[model samples]
Structures are given as structure tokens and as C-alpha cells.
Target: MKFRKATSENVQAIVEMIADDPLGSKRENYTIPLPKTYYDAFERIDADPNQELIVVENDIGQVIAVFQMTFIPYLTYQGGIRAQIEGVRVHKDHRGLGIGKTIFHWAIQRAKERNAHVLQLTTDKKRPDAIRFYESLGFNASHEGMKMHF
Candidate 1:
């Protein structure tokens, strides 16, 4: 498998993988012609220097996973960069193939390459398996994460 920045052509596949999950199915509109919002969000991410929207492809060049990494410059860490990963999803057909670990290793190395002081992510409380997987990767639940949705 190969990791690369996601292109416009890969948006649909990415969204499909994302929506394959129960949580995502509740939120994402995965349709024949996906909503304009998805493309617009992709364009914004593509343009941002601090954001990397990525796709993982199989040997045959089929998209098998998707994730986004955001590097935030912070005053709290003495002007350090904090790498935040979100929206990670592996295609339903490709689960349990170690692709998740592979992509995470890639993301971690990428974060280090960018001089990030810490790499962080949040998994929904509902996904115990995801939490365990992240723990296996050496992440800790260091802080309580809270969010408000409008």
C-alpha cells in the first residue's frame, strides 16, 4: 500500500470508507453525487499548508483508507507544533489487514518530520476497539476531550 495526499478524484472513495461506519452513517450523506460540502471541504484542506488530507491505496491503486492530519502551532508547548489526526477510516473490505497500523506509522513519521512535539487523536467513546488499537500504538488518554456541536 502507498500513502499520498488525497486528490479530488479520491473524495468519493474516501467518503464511502468514512460512511461505512455506524457513527459516520449517522452524519455523512454518502450519495451518488456526494454533497458539495464534501468537495468544498477537500478543497480547503488541499489549500492549507498545515493540513494534510491523505489517502491510502492498495497495490492496484485502489483507495483503501483515508485520514487527515493537522499541524497546529502552539504557545503552550513553547512554540511547538502539535499534530492532530482525525477522520481516519479504512474501507470495510480492507479491515484487519494491518493497513491501519501501516498508515498510523506513516502519520507518526510524517508528524516527526514536520517537527511536531506531540501527535494526538481522539476516538469516539463508543469505539472500544479503536481505543485499544491506539493504545497499542503508544497513545495515552492524556486529557479529556470535549466538543460542542452546533
Candidate 2:
């Protein structure tokens, strides 16, 4: 498998992977919806230098997973950056094969290289398996994260 930064060419595959999930039906925030023009995703990712979209490809160059990471810089943390991981998804057939873990480790290392103090992400309470996966990777559930949809 090979991993690389995502480009507009991979948007369709990434969108399909994310929307295929069950939770995405109700939460319109996790992943970008399907049938979108590639330019949309391209513009968004291009606008933010601190944000990155990445993809994982199989040996034949087929995209099988996608995720985005956002780095938030703060002065309170002694000029540290915090990496917020979101929109992580692996193709249904590609799950349980360590692709997710590999991408996550890559993201963590990227964060560390950028002087990030924390790498954080949030999963819906209903995704117990996801929570366990994050915990297994050394992430802790310590804060009460609340969001209000506008």
C-alpha cells in the first residue's frame, strides 16, 4: 500500500467512502457528501495551509482510504500547534487491514514534526468501536467536547 497527500483527483473516491458509513446519514459533518465536483474539495483544502487531505492507495493505485487533518496554532500552549484529525474513512472492503492505523501513525508523526502539542479527534458516542480504536492508539477521553449546530 502507498500513502500520499490527496489531490482533487481523489475527491470522488474519498466522498464515497465517507458517505458509505452509517453515522454519516445523520451527521452531515464528518465527510464531504458524494457527487460533489472535485474543484470544491480542491479549493477548500488549498485555502488552508494548516489543513491537509490524504489518501491511501493499494498497489495498483486505487484509493482505499481518506482523512483530513487540521493544525490549530495557539499561543496559550506556549506557541504549540494542535492537530485535529477528522473525516477518517477506509473503504468498506479495506477495513481491518491496518490502513487506518497506518494513516493515523503517519498523521501523528507529521504533527510531531510540525511541533504540535496534541493530536486530537472526536468520535460520536455511539461509535464505541471507534472510541476503542482511538484508545488503543493512546488517545484518551478526558474532555467533554460540545458542539452546537447552527
Candidate 3:
């Protein structure tokens, strides 16, 4: 597997990967025709210096996994910066093959290179396996995550 920055042409595959799971199937619409919002969002992400949209491709050059890492600069924590991991997904055929571990290692190296004090992510409570996987990767569930969706 190889990791690379996601290009505009990868938007469709990225969306499909996100929608591959049960939870995603209910929330994501990776259909034949997506709205302009998805493309617009991709444009913004590509243009942002503090955000990285990454894609992992297989030996056959198929996009199998994707995630976004965002660097947040804050005055708190002695003016430390932190990296947030979002939307991490590996293709069904690629799971349990250490691809997720490789992705996290990449993300951690990136965070360290960027001088980030913390690398964090949130997983749905329903995904027990994900929670365990993350914990095994050295992430601690020290606090509860709360969010209000519009």
C-alpha cells in the first residue's frame, strides 16, 4: 500500500469508501451523482495549508483508505499545536492487514514533523472494534466526546 495526497479525481472513491460501512451508509450519499457541496469541500481542503486529505492505494492502484489530518494552532497548552485525525477508513478488503496501523504511523510521523503536541481522533461509540484498535495504537479514551449536529 502507498499513501498520497488525495486529488480532485479521488473525491468519488473517497466518498464511496466512507459510505461502505453500515453507519456511513445511513449518513453518506456516495451515489451516482453527488452534490456540488462535496466538490466544493474538497477544493477548500486542498487549498488549506493546515489540512491534509490523504488516500491509500493498493498494489493495483485502487484507492482503499482515506483520512484527513488537521493541524490546530492554539494559545493554550503553552501555545502548543495539535493534530486532529478525521474520517479514517480502510476498504473492506484491506482491513486486518495492518493497513490501519500503517496509516496511524504515517499520521503520527506527520504530526511529529509538524511539531504537534497531540494527535487525536474520535470514533463512534457503536464501533467497539475501532475503539479497541485505536487504543491498541496508543490512543487513550480519557474524555467523553460530545457534539451537536445541525
Candidate 4:
């Protein structure tokens, strides 16, 4: 599999994968066209130098996975940068094939290249399996993450 930056065209596939899950089905309305918010976010991500919205594709060139990794500069950790990853998803057909591990491994190396002192991500408390998957790859639950949706 190969990884590449997600272009405007890949957004639909990415959202579809996200919606395939029970939790996402209620959130993503795929019965019709995707909402404009997704497009807006895509445009914003494309403009941000620190944000990397990436997609993974198979040898056949089919987009199968998606994630966004952001490199945030900060004064913490002796001024070292931090790499934050989110929206990680693998297509149902591609699950259980080590693609998630490959994505994480690549993100770690990318973080190191950018001089990130730490690589971080937050998974929903409901996703115990995902948390365990992350732990298997050396991520720790060092902090509690909270968010307020608009």
C-alpha cells in the first residue's frame, strides 16, 4: 500500500469509511451528498502547512485508508514540536491487514523527522479495541482529552 495526501476527490471515500461505523452512521448523512462542512475543512487543511490529510491506497490505486496528522509547534517539551493524529480509518475490506500499524509507523517516522517530542492521538472511550490497538503500537493514555462540539 502507498500513502499520499488526500486530494479533493478522496474526501467522499474517506467520509464513507467513517460513516460505515455504527457511531459514524448517525453523524455522517451519506443518504445524499456530503455536507459542505467537509469540503470547507478540506480546503482549510490544504491551506495549513502543519496539517497533513493523508490517504492510503492499495497497489491497484484504490483509496482505502485515511488519517490526518498535524505538526504543532509549542514551547512545551523543551520547545519540541508535537505530532497529533486524528480521523484514522481503514476501509472495511482492508481491516485486519496491518494497514493501521503501517499508518502509525509512518506517522511516528514523520513526527521524528519534524522533531516532534511526542506523537499523540485521542480515541473515544467507547472504542476499547482501538485504544488497545494504539497501545500495541506504543501510544500511552497519558492525558484525558475533552472536547465541546459546536
Q: What TM-score, computed on C-alpha atoms, does each candidate reach?
A: 0.98, 0.89, 0.96, 0.94
Winner on TM-score (1 vs 4): 1
How large an RMSD does model 2 have?
A: 2.8
Candidate order by decreasing TM-score:
1, 3, 4, 2
Q: Give the higher-lDDT candidate: 1 or 4.
A: 1
Which 10 residues in a row give candidate 2 its minimum summed lDDT? 28-37
Instruction: Give all candidates' CA lDDT scores.
Output: 0.95, 0.84, 0.94, 0.92
- Per-residue lDDT for 1-117 in model 2, tens only? 787888877777876777677877555343445435456766789688999888889999999988888999988788889999999999999899998889889989989988898
Task: Summarize candidate 4's per-residue lDDT along 24-125 as a digit string, tens digits.
Answer: 988887654789888898999999999999999999999999999999998878888999999999999999999999999999998999888889999989
**Candidate 3 lDDT, tens digit per residue, 33-93?**
8767789999999999999999999999999999999999999999999999999999888
Query: Could you say which candidate leads in TM-score?
Result: 1
Question: Could you give candidate 1's per-residue lDDT for residues 1-150 as a string of tens digits?
Answer: 889999999999998988898899999999989999999999999999999999999999999999999999989878999999999999989999999999899999999999998999999999999999999999999899999999
Error of 1 at 4 (Å): 0.6
TM-score of 2: 0.89
- What count of clashes does model 4 give? 0
Candidates ranked by lDDT, best first? 1, 3, 4, 2
